[model samples]
Target: MVVIAKQNVVDILLMEAFYEMHQVRDRLNFFQEKYQQTFENFSVFMKKENENFEYFDDYMEWKAYTKLFDEVLKKIEELKNGNFQIALTALR
Candidate 1:
């Protein structure tokens, strides 16, 4: 078989890079929307389900939500704070 041209290889690699970039951008946007929606939904659920907030005293439940919010909201904050590179690095 004949070897491929360097120019041809570069063209193929460039196309692949653009395609991958589009995919990553789309995926990132999707998760950003989904995360906001899911958090708002569950927040509403929690408020409606727990009228008195008595559950706040429960270490098991409190720690669970605390951990979840810390992980999710921290990244959101970092992204908003112009530390998106850090957030992306952390994501990786």
Candidate 2:
């Protein structure tokens, strides 16, 4: 049997959260470079113009990535602040 310290668990979670944040930032950057605009500007453009399938698809995907980035950032902040609860159970 092995025991893991609480701080170790928090460290692991923080590492993973940081990795996720990096990945989400990469995705957001991809969309920004591709369209040469921020999501808000792209959204406004989409609303003004006739709908194109590719742009619409990219918009939806970019929107999801944007939301995920925000959520991951929040998770990272919580982990850094020690605001998370965790339970560990041993396996037989």
Best by TM-score: 2
Model 2: lowest-lDDT 10 consecutive positions = 83-92
Tens digit of per-residue lDDT, candidate 1, span 47-86: 6665455533332343454455455555544434545321
Query: Candidate 2 residues 1-92, lDDT tens each?
Result: 57788889989988998999899999999999999999999999999777599999999999999999999999988888989888666768
lDDT score, candidate 2 = 0.92
Q: What TM value does model 1 have? A: 0.35
- Listed in order, each prediction's TM-score against the native is 0.35, 0.91
Candidate 1 segments whose C-alpha is farther than 4 A from its true place = 36-92
For model 2, what is the error of residue 15's alpha carbon versus the real structure, in angstroms, after optimal superposition?
1.0
